[model samples]
Each structure stands twice: as structure tokens, then as C-alpha cells.
Target: MAEKRTDRALDRTELIKQTTLELAQELGFTKLSIEAVAARAGVGKHTIYRRWPSKGALFLDALLPADAQALDIPNTGDIEADLRTQTYAAVDLLGRPPFGPLYQALLGEAQHDPSVAAALNERFIGPQAQRVRARLKLAQRQGQVAPELDLDLAFAILSGPLYFQFLIAQEIVTHGYIDRVFSALFAGMRPSP
Candidate 1:
């Protein structure tokens, strides 16, 4: 009986989290409130407070995907092809509606809120960056890239143009842009005389 009760509680918490994310997507995080989330989740405000200490914490949890799969890079051992694949995946992630808006809001809020900034960095940015760095290191070892190339700088070189188009220019980061960038970057940074 106690086990069943615990399962029910866990289910309710999951529902609350899902509902909160939906609400946050529809209404910006700044306008979201515990009462609104509780109403959407069909739970009491106390239930939310019992689980999360602050709005930022709850919002952070909500922003996370339900399954939360890690970004996977294909290891074809062809540096340029692998990078193009990774760039496309990144553009796809950034172009999704709710996810895009939520990320933009997070970036904006992070500028003002230290706690939110830390949570965003820890949850999203750091893990993705680590994976990319590892891939870059592998490419270097394979002699597919220049030995003296900086991994961090390389990532910026590849992603910066996309970021400028999407975040600043409010333009779609198209397939053509990805191909062009990948071609240019790989050509300039290839291991050669």
C-alpha cells in the first residue's frame, strides 16, 4: 500500500513538471506562477512548494525534456562530415518552436538572474560543450584536423555564424549556411602544409 502511494505521488510530480513546462512555453517564465502551474497540473500550491523550493528551480526542471536524451555525434571518422551532421542537429534543436522560445527566454533571463544563468549553464551548455570537445579531440587524434587548432576556438568558429544568424539577425540557419560554414571551416582548418 505504501509503495502504491509513493508511485502515485511520483506520477503526480511528473505530471506537474510536464504541465509546468507546457505553461512556461505558452506563457513566458517571468509571467509563470505557482498558482498557474498548480491549476494546470490540477494540484495544490503546497504540493508544488513541497517539491520545489523556488520558481527558478521548478522552471529549470520544467525546461528539461521528459526523456532528456544526450546529444549524440556520429563517429564516421570523417571530420567534416561529422561536423556537418552535428551542426545540422544543433540548428534543428534551436529551430523548434517551444524549445527555441524557451531557450531564448533562458538566455535573456540569464543575463539578469545569476541563479537562472548558473542553472542554464550547468544543465544545457556545459554537457553539450564537453561532448563537442571530446569529438574535436578525437578528430585531432585521427589527423583529420590541425594539431595546433584550439578545440574551444574551433567550436566558436563553427557555431558563431549560426548563432549570429539565429539569435541576432533573427534569420533561419539554413542547410546552405551549415554546408558553407562546414566547408569553409574544414578547408581552412584541415591538417596540411
Candidate 2:
């Protein structure tokens, strides 16, 4: 009997998470409310609060995939090639409208809500940022990048232009743009005199 109750609880949580994500995708995170999420999930508002104390916590939980795929960064032994691969992947992600809107909403909310910002930074940004840092370290080890290159700055250089083009300029991130950025970054960071 106890096991059955636990199973039901798990099922309810999964249902709520799925419903919240679907609603967030359809209606922008800024417009999502606990009452609406509860209605869509077919669960009571109290039930959601019991699982997560606040809407931000619940939203973060829903944002994460239950079977999230791990990113596989290629180590082609050519640092510039690997950086280009990573940057292109980021461009692809930013170009998708559904996800793009969701991210924009979250970022905007994060500006006002520290708790939500912390959760977003911890769960979403931190891991991806670490991946980029690791890739930079690998390049340094391979003697492809300058020994004194500031990795944080390198990351900015690799991703900043792409974000500007996609999010600000409202331009499509193309292969040519990625190639141009890669060329510029390599020119600056390549082993120098």
C-alpha cells in the first residue's frame, strides 16, 4: 500500500512537470502562473506547492529534461575546429524560436528574481559554461591556444558575436558567420610571438 502511494506521487510529479513545460512553451514563462499550471496538470495548486515551494522552483524543475542528453564536445585535436563546432551548436540552439522565447523570458525574469536567477545559473548556465572552459583547457594542453589566453574572455569572443547576431540583430546565424568568428578568434588566440 505504501509503495503504491509513492508510485502515485511520482506519477503526479512527472505529470505536473510535463504540463508545466508544455504550457511554458505555448504561453511564455512570463505569463505562466501556478493556478494555470495546476489547471493544466490536473492537479491542485497545493500539490504543486507541496513539491516545490515557489513557482520559480517549479518552473526550474520543469525546464530540466528527465532524460536530458549530455553534450558531446568533439576533440578533433584542432582547437579552432572544435571551437567552431561548439559555437555552431550554440547558434543552432539560439535560432530555434520556441526555445529562444523561453530563454529570453527566463533571462528577463532572472533580472528581478535572485532565487530564480541562481537556479537558472546553477542548473542551466553553469554546466554549459564548464563545458566551454574544459574545451579551452584541452586546447591549451594541445598547444593550439596561447598559454596566457584568458579562457573567460575566449568564451566571450566565441559566443558573443553569435548571440549579438541572433538575439539582437535578429539575423540568422549562418555558416559564414560562424566561419568568420572562428577565423577572428583563431587569429587572436593562436600561439603568438
lDDT score at residue 174, model 1, on the 0-100 scale? 85
TM-score of 1: 0.87
- C-alpha TM-score for every candidate: 0.87, 0.87
lDDT of 1 by residue, 126-177 (tens): 7777878889899989898999889999888877898788878888888898
- Model 1, global lDDT: 0.82
Q: Please estimate how well model 2 matches the true structure, expressed as its whole-model Cα lDDT.
A: 0.79
List model 2 lDDT by residue over 1-193, tens digit each. Answer: 9999999999999999888888888887878899999998888999999988777777777765535653556888887777678767766776786666666666667777888788877776777778888988888888888989999888887778876876678688888889988888789898876
Q: In model 2, what is the error at residue 21, expressed in angstroms?
A: 2.1
Best by lDDT: 1
Off by over 4 Å in 1: none
